[model samples]
Target: MAIVKMEKMHLLALKSEQSKLMQTLQKTGIVEVIDITGDKKEEEKQGHKEDRIRDEIAKELAELETKLNNLKLGIDFLKPYSKSPNPLIYGKPDVKKDELSKILSNETKIAESLQRVFDLDKKIAQLKSEESKILNQIDFLIPWQGLDIPLEQLGNTDRTAFVAVVIPRKSKDKLEEKAKESQLPLDIKVIGEKRDDLYALIVYHRGYNEDIQSLFKEFSVTIQDFMGLKGTPNDIIEQSKRRLSDIQKEREDIKTQAQGMNQDLFNFEVLYDYYMVEKDRKTNTLKLFDTDKSFYLQAWLPKERKSYITDTISKITDMVYVEFTEPEENDDIPVLLSNSKLVEPFEVITELYSLPDPRGIDPNPYMAPFYWLFFGMMLSDAGYGIILSLFTAVALLKFKLEGSGRKFVSMFFLCGISTIIWGAIFGGWFGDLIKIKPLWINPLDNPMSVLILSFILGIIQIFTGIILNGYKNIRAGNTADAIMDQGLWLVLLTGLLMFAIQPLAGIAKYVALFGAIGLILTQGRAQKNPIMKLASGVMSLYSVTGYLSDLLSYSRLLALGLTTGVIATVINTMAKTVGGSAIGFVVMILILLGGHVFNILINILGAYVHSSRLQYIEFFSKFYDSGGRAFDPLRIKTTYVKLEDL
Candidate 1:
């Protein structure tokens, strides 16, 4: 709540003491420093470099993850076609990076091969689908001995609706006589038609298949002519598979080569890791010589370690540099390198839910508890609360999420806790599961009681913020403002407002007049100018309305609670009706699942958003600097490979 005053440190320290302080500060973080004056540039450069390294690591990890995703899909698809149900058992449990890269390359090539095969497969399938239609059309032409449909004319060509049987033009009248008596089994499109001498051009289908090649071959002579140029699709398909196999074998060899390189890369990385630690231990170590970094340490360690080196080191170390101050503030909070602010509670929950990433920002300390309370308020049904807690626990324990999924699940858990309490108060759980109805009517049944409780809660929370603000302000040495502008004024105004609108208690009348007079007098001194100060006093009196406004805004809590209970009641009634019949029972199951899920989602969102609004507008307006930087400690951050385990 309050910032602790830092005792001005002056100290003569052993080289070791300064180093320990630096390490301590590193653990806490850089952002907590009001000012960093010495060797700032080097620190900045180191920080940037660290960030870049982390980014590179992230990029590589993302590539690995993507490859893993593709492999998963490929594995799923190829499962039935595979040599065994467990391809993983056929090989090593983990693939080396180089081998993985090669595998990915081959995976791409194989996918392309599959595409080629699929396209051919599509053509073949379509040909098979059209088999009956083509056969039916050509059925009549089958018995025509030398009436001759040439295999070469099998594709696209036009035909006249009827051909005259005459050998010369003089026999055209005979053709017309034959046409009048016969009909041709044909498909035609008449291109041109005339009246006196009917003229026409027509269109029809010509079918081709490889099986027909042998029957049509009698029309040709030489070996080249006998074969013609018929391309069979099966031959192409087999050839593609062969090429794919060859490519796969080639990829295997490349993988073998890459496997050898993997060791070299690993060794290089391990060696680099050792070098970094060694270098950090050396260059950044404290020395007896005066340095710019404003840190020194004093400790009551055993006097034996300061033996022969102590006297000589004292000559180089400043003679006037010793001071004693008790530790505060940072002692309790666990420090990390990436802390940037009062890390939100939401972020903390995220950390709890997911695998910790070194580079991630923690917002959990700030956001979680409030977020939970807000969520509970939004969905004030006990049944929903119990449901949320169980569901979240199952999900978080079962199939864990890596990033924001973890945060949300954690948030639900916290919300569930709050909801349980509120639900008990509101007589929730399908309207009192244990017949533990609320002492007072539920928010739905008694709106006034709900509003009154909401206001009281709001007042308590608001005052809590004010008290915290006063503490911080006074500690930060803004005494005048803490007393006049913040603390005194808030107390006075809140007191007056509470007393003015109450089931007037014993001291209500006395408290209101005292609070009002104090507010009017103190608020008058806020401005330096006489005229402005006078007007400020006048506004202070009018600010009774402002107090009313703040108190009234809390009614939204009731509104939200009412909204949840009403929605649940509707769902419950619907579920009862649906459970009446067999079909209805099935529908009820779906409705309950879907409706409750939707309700949970919507209410959770509403609670969080509205709660945050109150905190920012009503609560935080009291006193929150929100400008303090988070403590950051310099350290290696890793996820997949646990360091202690390693």
Candidate 2:
């Protein structure tokens, strides 16, 4: 049965009667103009005002963001000098009043010290980069390929940071012994009393594996704990003493501000709030229609489609008691404007989420079938289908995403499964060996079957449309005429398909010939249009070519499936041939990896596009209405503050 998507008029009126229409609209979260374009503006005296708290907080957050940006700039300016080559000492945060004052009064010294420390880091990083370049070159050889070893087992995990340690200061003798055994050269430095330890910092001259902890453990480096003293910078002390005074003043200002809100500042904010608000403000009204009741009925239609009112609303029902009049003129305002021909999908999704209670059911309940069918047909490759469905399944299970991305992903998963079934029926196992005998003939070898199937599907969906039209007619209280006009068309199309005009033979043709007669007599029965009526009836026959062409398009789905499988097969074949030569083994492996990856990427894209095309043309045309506004409530929104909180 075709679905009717209409609400009972009287019930809809009841919903709008109690609350302010403007408030309900504002709550929708759509960007809207504040001007009272219509007479539905809020009543200022009663005070059911929109929440300003969130907006105010949002404004304050924006200002804070600007200030934070400036603060970052100031901090960045002092960074270069603070990162000089000398290391800086870390002191405990000052707790005593005098000690805290002293540190605050020496911002120049602090900034300078910090810069020198950064400089030291840069120097060390540069040295390490050079050392690693040489190591990488040496490791390019096969013998060093699996030589990653750990240093932690040698007991060195707790040190601040150590590059490399040569063992035994006099390891000259020990190193000589090791060199003799391994045929490897070593350079060791003597250190400590009596030069008993022949250890030198190897500068980790090789790159520090960025994954140092793993490297330490892997290299089996022993950490006998740290032994070095904290390094001091003797050269920077004089410079720090000379630059203290000017920075001290700036530091004190920063300190005072960080100490939190004072009474005067808090009072100033309250005063500012008072200065901005008015104790008495006038009200605004948005009156859509104000007049004595009569035969007229006002519709809150898609404001853009107001021009099509007479045609759409008039045909939907048979209530002579109600009539629609033109909306009263108003100044131009920016808002969605559309005539009845078409509405975008975004708007359709939106409408589904909102809309009040209705007598006629929403069309959404019926579109699911056409949607699923088209989705499956477009994505009809078992291989891509399996991947798409499984990927979406994992995402859905692991995380809850929302809005367009979520809906799109969900659609892909659904269509993918459908594609899998279609692929199976077509005997398309990623273009595996073509089957000679299958439950359904493959699209490649048997194009005629797919064409016929496509036609059958079109007929089925069109029949569904006809049935729904009949239901809409009957629901309007013209049960007999609904059957005559709508039911007659269904029988007419069925006769054309089944009887084929040949079976009807002579006298039997008389029954099939009644379609136009029925339309001429009954179509627009309220208005006289005999010739035009018959013409409208003939329009149904115009579908011969549309049906032919659209059905042919379905074969593309088969073509795409074939492409995905054929390409993968070709890649494998070429790669295997290349691998046959002794010297070509590695090259063949690379070719195999590169070819399959490329094929998978391209096929995935093709599957997505083909699948999407089916939904848009075949399924959506079947009754997939897509112009509803989505319902969204207010949400807690934050950007930087929460991210920076820690």
Candidate 3:
């Protein structure tokens, strides 16, 4: 594993040729454009405006961004209706060179189609709003269907005042008594009842209005207003039902029309990618410095891509100037990992933690083996391993996964293989559902053996990390630090282990003492005071406890490994208990299926989390130097389609 070497790039081209050159660079997809004009305003503040070029593409970029947003909205609107292929099965739609060119030239067709979709979406929105209002009206009117008078006719006449009131069913009798006491021309009619309230219409003489109004308020009356409605309750409900039916039909028609334009959705995606390419070019163009007739561009790119970029640009225009130079020590060089196909998937682990420093060693190749072993041991079930391997293998073969998605699937596929191996070694096939002889030791029968194995693996990995740290120090010309730090620790640990052997006990004591003396003398060499140096060196021995704690973390491997097998065994036992009759057999099958699936899912999560913990906390902490920025170049990035030519 290695970090790809990078070089600084300087480019000068005619202002007229800027667009063409940018297009070329984007297609190459290697150059990371540097923003040299970042301090334009600062320079202007200092009264040096002659060297500044007015941002020519800013307005165009803004317009393009707006158009892109609208286009994206249109696509999202139609996505529910379109019969798009499943991304998991088909990946992004691929457009060949001729197809792309054809779609690019037919911009008018796509624009018209997008407008039509937008119009239909707007229509649907309006229809939905109308539908909501009609539904509400229908609900309100259904409770008043017994009211015979039209809503408009319920208003006051010349002699009497008419008002619709709703009061509690228990308050109805009190209102009747109050109306009787008023001795006015007050008529109260119970029109309808809903829940705990009665809908009533009250008509009273205007001369008795104050008395009738007071009685109405004292009876807990709620006045209903249908002032904007023209028809009776029954008439309004019927009309609303008819309108709802019509709205439903109209919405269905719109959905049908939108679904019919799914082909245009694909074309819209192509045009989106085209605009994206253009937008990126314009964005990077702002990073350049321009004069009256020429522009200057600076970038960083992989050193190996130098010849390819130079040749490609030279073919386009011979007048352009290009230069490449070694990156300076202080330059913020971006990190790109390069590894073998087998080791590549493990890069996702390092990436999730952080990319390794450009000047340090790549840890993927070293950390991957331990991660694989740990994951397999944690999920040691042959049947589940087979399923994982087959599923991931099929996905890798049938689906076009890219970037982290591809790496993740690939990693699980390899981990599945490791699981199979460990499963066989531990004699764990579906947790003893199938009778098989032990290839090695059954962890359930002899857990201590497996615990010892986990500890040994942890010790080996720890030593590997320390050696890698030593390598990094040696590479950086810090041999003294490597010997005093990594070398002495290894010696001490090795001697401690040797103490377990009877024959080496005598030598082990001296070996351990020598390592301790060396660390005590050198670990505090940076301190100035002699007394402080001795105290610091004495304190350094406490780190052995930290190392012991890290080593203990590996026991999770045995713990989780046992957890998977034990749970599988419990499921099998439960399933067996239910199996006697034909129906019982069916129940047993269901239990086995559901239980094993759940067990696999839960343990897989545990394995992944714990496995990564070992790497990040135990392994990487020893040697990994993070904080390098990832490489992000100006290139054609698309969401819905892949450009075959590019």
Q: Pick the candidate with the highest TM-score.
A: 3
Reference-based lDDT, residue 393, model 1 = 80
How many steric overlaps does candidate 1 have?
Answer: 23
C-alpha lDDT score of every prediction, in listed order: 0.49, 0.44, 0.89
Kindly report which residue pairs in candidate 3 clash with one another. none
lDDT (Cα, tens digit) per residue for candidate 2, span 311-401: 4334434332333233244422222322121212222332433331222324434444555565555444566567678987787666544
- Candidates arranged by lDDT, highest first: 3, 1, 2
lDDT string, candidate 1, 1-646, tens digits: 1122223223444433554544443332221222222434654444554455445545655554554344344333333333332312232123354644454355545455344434534544455455444444333222222223332333433532222111222333444344334432233222222232222211222232222232224322111121232222233334445655665565455445434443333232232333333333323332212333333333221122233224434454553354434435443222232332233325543333332222222233333455566557667877778888898888777653544566567666767878888888788774332456774568877788778778777777766666666666686788876786566557566566556555755566566667666656678785888888777876777866765676677778888888887876787678777687889999988877777778767887787678767766666555543323233223322222112211
* Cα error of candidate 1 at position 378, Å: 2.8
Q: Which of the two candidates, 2 or 3, achieves a greater lDDT against the reference?
A: 3
Query: Which has the higher lDDT value, candidate number 1 or candidate number 2?
Result: 1
Better of 2 and 3 by TM-score: 3
TM-score of model 2 (CA atoms): 0.44
TM of each candidate vs. truth: 0.51, 0.44, 0.93
Q: Could you tell me the TM-score of candidate 3?
A: 0.93
Instruction: Indicate which candidate wins on lDDT.
Output: 3
